[model samples]
Target chain A: MTRIDYTDLVGGLGLVLTGAAVSYVSISQYPLGTLQRMGPGMFPAILGVLLAGLGVLLSLQALRRPGSRPDIRIFSPLFVLGGIAAFALVIVPFGLVPAILAITVISSLAELRVQPVSLALLTLALCLMAPLVFVVGLGLPISLVRWPF
Target chain B: MEFLANIGLGFSVALSLTNIFYCFLGAFLGTLVGVIPGLGVLAAISMLFPLTFHLEPTTALIMLAGIWYGTTYGGSTASILLNLPGTPANAVTCLDGYPMARQGRGGVALFMTTVASFFGASFGIVLLTLFTPVIADYALRFGSAEYFALMLMGLVAASTISEGSAVKGLSMVVLGIIIGLVGMDSQSATVRFSFGVMGLLEGVSLIALAMGVFGVAEIIMSVRRVRTADIDPETLRLKAIKPSRDEMRRSWFPMLRGASIGSFFGTLPGTGPSIAAFLSYAIEKRVSRTPERFGNGAIEGIMGPESANNAADQTAFIPTLSLGVPGSATMALMLGVLMIHGVAPGPNLISSQPELFWGLIMSFWVGNLILLLLNIPLIGVWVRMLTIPYHILYPAVLMFICIGAYTSGFTVLNVWMVLVFGALGYAMRIFGFPGAPLLLGFVLGPLMEEHFRRAMVLSRGEFLTFFERPISAVIMALTGMILIWSVWSAEIIRRRRAARAAGDGATTHEAREG
Candidate 1:
């Protein structure tokens, strides 16, 4: 027989860990009063246990019948995530225009190889459009350009 | 009659110049987003959530409603042309729409679907007009126990009906509830899970959760499939839009049947347009004499599902407007908009805010009419819109999402939340868990908790109070039945799949022996 699906196993593990973390926080941090007078943490603690139980059930089911796994590429997520991080870093200090340009050019790299001309054109278009639509039209208070230094 | 008077009031409000302008703008923008694959109406609405923050509630709602239905009209464009669905609602359209396009009947298919959509929407609007008052009146008597039961039913139905592993869907729902709990505990005045972050005190922004999971995660998934060259949209001749008489004759009843099915499912919480569309398609397949034509560019294939989805979109507002229980994620977003404008939606909303209710209903008719007019002649523009490559389109979507997230609370913290949820959402997708339930869970979680707490308090913490109340008992019984039905159905599906696999294996073995 084919090997058991590692993806479901991993998913089951992740869910269990998340449930455990929530349960831990709920138990340690908050007050869980008796059944008659439920405290703030009572509901969350119940939900955490439910989640962990479900995860365990899923793991057991996975052993009986393996499921299909998805193809996970490494670089695309990196570039996409990196682009958002770049925007977050720049939006305050560097300003809207640079942030837009950074996010646009950086995210386009998720396609692996970017056509420089198209990338530049997209950057220019976004730089104009973002300011016009967001700042000028909608009147969000952000300067067009700023130098962090 | 009272109905006529209400209609008159609605028309007076909806026909105002300002409302018209907003409606037109929403339809135009909604079509643009819907035509572009990967930008579903939920993401688009969340991305534009900031834009409406400044408008009057009525105008904001009118525009939002326009966008919701407009997307329904425009979602079919991509399915017809590229076999790609702009939203889950339109996914069924690709079965025959692309085939029809390949056979050079693309224009005709588009025209028929548009007409079918209008028919279905009109039917739904009529139902909405008649039923909203009745449902609202009935729901007025519901106590906390009933409301809790209803919300629980909605969550369970959503988890089971969503197309994936039920366990994973339920887990996601629980996860969403946990996420919803990540703010100040309103009852006790103690901070629950903010982890000392100031942003968590106010709660995780809905726009961030939506834009991240639906918008940003979609971009992440689409990265691998990005084609450098855009599709040629001009090849489909726009002039060939007229349907043949035979096709027209076959479609009318199917449209009506589809509308009825759509309306039924749309009123039920947790069931949305996608389910309505698929169910309508299945019904059409079963009822048709020549069922063999269904997958091979059949006119019924395009007409039934398209109409059903559009009808479903309209009737989905029934639960949201009257009961104040959003039927889907998009409807939940609209509920958020209502709350943002300080208009609490519930049984009392229709009575307290008749102008808002009637005006919104009237605006739906106007919007659908506008969508019909817009879709017919503007097919060329939408088709041409397909030529824009994903690389360009996604960056623009990402930028809007970032801006929208930031604007949700005017804090950068929400933008950070977007990144975190986007990664989490992508992981969910990789593991084949349905995101819709997660969204529904997030939207309804806080409300569910509040109702549950209130019920518990009233009963002095006796859990039996849930079953003691008549309405709550009936609702809970229904929820239980639905859960059992879904579990049974899932088992049947698995057994059938296994049997098919075994059959194939046996056939291969016999072939080798022979």
Candidate 2:
């Protein structure tokens, strides 16, 4: 007997749910005209149904064999994604310099060992270099430093 | 002859001071990123894409194309030295190249691969020059039916031929198509999955999607994983790069064979340099008289794949330029760049924009020559770059991704989109679903729907019109065969594994009875 692969099962179920939701929304919200003249929703509705069918097939296939489990790491994604979020939050309000410093400090924490002096130095260099390259050289419209208040 | 005139036109444009300067800058940056172990060509291109907005369309394309082909040359340096591919296309090189490095022939490997790359690029460029006009002339006769059929074949082939579960790949393509539908319905002027968000009216930005998936997601995965490799400085010296006459003689035939194979695959839709490199390496191993020496520092192994990838990189432009259908995700991004510049790529592109066509081809020649000159003397500088730690690198890369995403739309919303897609991309990677097919689908989805709707209207709702057309029928038949073959082969492999397991179980039972 084959072992149940939970990863495959969950992934397939997620696909099926997404497909079903898309199909439902497409059919209900928009018009599906005749084959000669397709409405806006016609292509998406067909695609959603096909996706659901494929998802069913995938789930069935998983029952016949085992599949590899995903290798999940928390540290890298947490800090890396966190850093991007921080930059997005800081950029408009605090300007380019603070945004650069924000992302650099946050993302550098993903490394196992964080050197304080080097981190500060790296942030300082980026604050100087990013503006020169992006603002002065490329002439992007963003400001170097701003106060929204 | 007209060919000579065209060549003259190409050289005139390519040799301009501004164009030459941009080409050299592109080659230099391409090598810089390609020599670094963690950075990839796609990430580098997307990060620098915003800078191109300020330049003319022709210059932008010339620079990007330079980067595309230049990376193939620089990738082998790291493969030979550290057994880590600088880009995915060079992964095959590490097998034989690392062994050669251990034997103190690293310099020779680098020199030969560079020469082989130039030769392969020249071969592919010659083919591109000869065949592009012919293919474009033929494509000019195609209608909406023919186009829809061809795009369908491209989507099917791209998803199925990739190295993973065919179902998962197909599902990802479908998901991308749905994502492509999120803006407005162009035909009917109806709002779609936008859900009243103002930003959704213009649809998802391709630059944001590309940078999020290829740039940020990659950084997330590679942050803690990659380590700097220690190098032996003596192996990279200029004096150590000279190869024996025997090694030179043995490599010529393999380079020819590899270039031929690479050209063939490169012209096909839904395949690119990585597949070409792998296939050529396998072919070289099979045709060798002393196959046992393959993994033990064989020069042919490194020569064949390196040559194959460079050739593929050059020829991949054939279909994209002639048919307006990209073979891979990177090609799709290039197409996006052209579209953003208000240039539509299709059959008339060669006739209408002769300068862009010929000039780009001539620049390939110039770019390859520049790479050949740059890579040899810059070996010491590149090796020193290997010592830069991952912690510092990832942070800087992250900063670029943020700035790039922001400038693409000049909105913080685009940055948020990058984060959302970055998380989606990372999750998809963990689930064993390939991202390239999804990208191809996103690029082609809207175009495919437009063609499909047009074809339907032309046929008066008769589904049999697809079968009635000669070209469409043939392509549709090929797509069907590939689908059936993939499913049948997967089933056969599964049953064979089960039988082997059952055989083992029976033998153990019989032994216990005895």
Candidate 3:
């Protein structure tokens, strides 16, 4: 017998878990008053229950479909997310230049075929332009150069 | 006479040198980003949102509105030259616009789209002038119940009409609402889902969310499929831009039809430019005598969808301005900006802020004119932009997204949030969830909750008050009808597929028996 698809089942499970987490947080962390004169938790708790119900519905729908293998990849998401994370981590302590350089170099690494010359050029261009646009034109408070050392 | 006086007041403000320069700047930047394949108008606007923080509210709105419509004009450039849609709304343009380019008519296609876009913008401006006052006046009668019903209808429309599974879209909307409900509650002053972070008190920043979903996600998507486009120089010849008399004749009615259709859908919340463009293309195909000529560079193919997209881009402002309900993510961003500036967008906005409304209206015309001037004679510049490699472009775009997120609240937490949502956005793209509905839900969540709470309070805990009010009841009924219709349609489609499969099985069995 052909196996029913679990791709959407996984999605449904994710939704249910998220919903459950939200509901738990709302119910326990905040006060859920009566329906008419509601507290902060009332709306979120309602939404959370509704989400869980929809997640179950989605899982049921997924069961009727023919299963297809999932495609998995790791590098692009990792490097791309790492790029932003690196920028976020560095921008405060080390400031904008290193952060901008780090993001440019790291994000470019996500490409299947990375060209070193172009990456350097991109880094150089962003290093020059980021300050011009964010700092000079907009006069944002962030400094261009601040080294912890 | 009142209309004329109002317009005169608008012109007086819009014609100021400062406003005109900013209007031109907006148009220029809009076209610049619109010419890039993965850099959408939303990304561009969010990246530049901080620039407008210093300008007066009216001027800021004028510039932002310029960017919105200017994108429609510039979106077709990539479609014509590289067969890549510069924006998602321009996807329909590629059906014929690319073929026209392959046929050495790229110059003419670009020129015709510019004219069509101008016609569409003019039509939408006329509609905006005619309808805004009427709608605002009508909206003035709205109580809490009616407002609640309307917002619910909008939210329902956004989720159901969006691409992918209705259930999935609904789930995304709910998720968005949950995200929106985070931070401190206005009434109870209770922190709902901040996880005890001090920065979450102001709520998730809209700029961060936009940059994450649109900008950073785009960079990630483009990185995997990055290729440089080669533009044919012959297509940019000045003489090649002029269409023959027959081509012009064929295009005239399609532009008008497209603009009319666009204005209708654009005024309806949740049905935005992409849907309008697709609908116009479908209508054009159905109406055309030579439907067979559509994919082979039919003039109507480019003219209809191009006009419709631009028209929709302009008229989408109607709900945002008059009703305080955003029609699209871009409109939501604009609405957000208005709120940030202490200007409320609602029925009272027209009476209270005549300068802002009229000046913004007038500036759209000036912006369209600037776009025409920018896109037509300066076509060579935008075409050249198509040649920049994805490797170089994505990094620059990523940098801007980072800065945009950081500046939104000037907090490191916002940048971190951008990273988190960016990864989620990429995942959603892979899984076939529509981002626009989620965005619309996020933007409107607080307003919907506010209206819901107010309506309940007014009714003294009676849920029937929503239906007791005539306008609210009618609106809610409309929402229910749409939900039912989608469900019915999904069932029919499922049944048809099953029957087709069964028929195929029977055919195979008969062949084996024979």
For each candidate in the order shown, give its overall lDDT on alpha carbons.
0.85, 0.87, 0.85
Relative to the true structure, candidate 1 reaches a TM of: 0.96
Candidate 2 lDDT by residue in tens digits, A98-146:
9998899989998868999989888988998999999998878898889
DockQ, Cα level, model 1 = 0.66
Model 3 C-alpha RMSD to native: 2.5
Better of 2 and 3 by DockQ: 2
Looking at model 2, residue B427 earns an lDDT score of: 83
User: Docking quality tier of candidate 2?
Assistant: medium
How many angstroms is residue B408 displaced in model 1 relative to the true structure, after the best TM-score fit? 2.5
Q: Please write out the lDDT profile of model 1 over residues B1-514, one tens digit for every residue.
A: 9889999999999999999999998988888888888778988888887889888899999998888888888889888888888778999999999899888888898899999999999999999999999999999999989998988888888788767777888898898888888889888988988988987997888888888888888889987585533444544556688889999999988898999999999888768899999999999999999999988999998888988998888899998998888878788889988987999988999899999999999998888888889999888888888888787788888888887777666678888898998898899888777777788788778888888888988998899998999999999999999889877888898778766766786543223334
Number of clashes recorded per candidate: 0, 0, 0
Give the DockQ (2 decimals) of all models. Answer: 0.66, 0.69, 0.65
Among the candidates, what TM-score does chain A have in each? 0.94, 0.91, 0.92
Clashing pairs in 2: none
Residue B366 displacement in candidate 3 (angstroms): 0.7
User: Model 1 segments beyond 4 Å from truth?
Assistant: B226-238, B506-514
DockQ measured for candidate 2: 0.69
Q: Arrange candidates by lDDT, descending.
A: 2, 3, 1
> What are the RMSDs of all candidates, in order?
2.6, 2.5, 2.5
